[model samples]
Target: MLLVKILKFNSALLTFLLFTSPIQANEFWGLESWMNSLKTPDFTKIKDVNQRKQAFFEYLLPEINKQNEKIVQLRHALKTDNINSFKLQKIYNRYRVKEGDIDTLLMRVDIIPASLILAQGAYESNWGRSRFAKYYHNFFGLWCFEKGCGIVPLKRDKAATHEVAKFSSLDKSVEYYMRSINRNSAYATLRKIRKNKRDKQAHITGLALAEGLENYAEIGYEYVETVQSIIRYNKLSQYDYKS
Candidate 1:
């Protein structure tokens, strides 16, 4: 297992480096444009669910792999007690993680399946047409309680003061979304669910993962159901093959 993991980490590092290389790096508006430019069709106008899922998943798969690759690298780092790698250490520092906190690091570094991510993005961003999605490129409906950490909802309830998180680009939003779920205590159950699926080599179902995100919205259960509905209606289960 250790040898296999090391080989996988090496390959992943090479691929990650290639993807980030200036020649290969796409210089687009990022996560938003990455999806918006898929098939060069306006994302909002795609009325066919299957076709929509195709365009979206084709774009999302590479990103999910990239995140999981990072997790693999982190796992390798801990297993080998290698903490000084620049890229891995930077990612750890960005997540406010300590070098030796393996469990916390694992939870923070793992991947959320593309199926669940796509389903949540579709629901939260209104098929990429919401104001947060359009203006802020925030596809995840993430909120920031700090005044400057996010944008204030114009019609926000006076009693509620949380602001919707904003991102400079779509990729940043996606990165933060994964980090938020992986690191936040609220999503521990969700992480555990994904971890269990990995351990058992079982296919991850967006419906099951939705159980872990009950705290994602004020409406709670309604939000989970809505996400599950989107996943089922779009056949997103086809994309949850990550193992």
Candidate 2:
């Protein structure tokens, strides 16, 4: 009876360990490898617009999906007190900030996918080659005219020095990018559409959001149309949806 009881206890503990192990341990490793593969390249050589768009979507969409799934699983593991699962979940959680920012903004307003934001970062900053991006962490081409705002890149302004906004870290840069769209005057229409969608309990749509960002680029209405084209041709709007 003593031996049988010891055997049963051991079996139960093994079962617990197996069941509590992280669900996506292999997947988490895969994600890290994938992220590391994305070495910044010379954007000038990537002159084909279609190719650039494809590369952007291919690189970004999977990361977003993986992070989103990890966030959900981590919340579940935390609730269940699965210590092993929690440890694995924490690895995935590191990427959740970027994913959560996308999810939260989508919940509030019809906005572009986090992939698009990454693409814009790649495009505007010339794949992290620009002086502002390399030194100041200005990922989104944000300009700052006020004193003590940011570093003034020599090539930024033709007539005089133009300050490029800086951030303490990459995460802060991403946060500022999101806030710039959600709160800035140029994006007022986008904010209103998002507010209207939330009030009505509607899913945020990218095309609708694009209409409001007409002034986002110097080309005004043309820029809006171009963004919509990028969304459609690449089927990027699919990333905007949550399941």
Which candidate's lDDT is highest?
1
Location of the lowest summed lDDT over 10 successive residues in candidate 2? 31-40
Worst 10 residues of 1 by lDDT: 32-41
Clash number by candidate, in order = 0, 0
TM-score of 2: 0.52
After the best TM-score superposition of candidate 1, give how far the Cα of residue 107 lies from its true spot, in angstroms.
3.0
As a whole number from 0 to 100, the lDDT of residue 181 in candidate 1 is 84
Compute the lDDT of residue 212 as modeled in candidate 2: 79
Candidate 2 colliding pairs = none
Q: Please give the distance, in angstroms, between residue 79's alpha carbon in candidate 1 and its true position after superposition.
A: 3.0
lDDT of 2 by residue, 1-243 (tens): 985686576557545655786647544433333332233233346678767555645544554455445444544554465547455444334333332253433332223445456546655776555755544556578877786567767655577655778664454565567656754667778767766775787866666677877777788888777667656665666677453
lDDT of each structure?
0.72, 0.57
Candidate whose TM-score is highest: 1
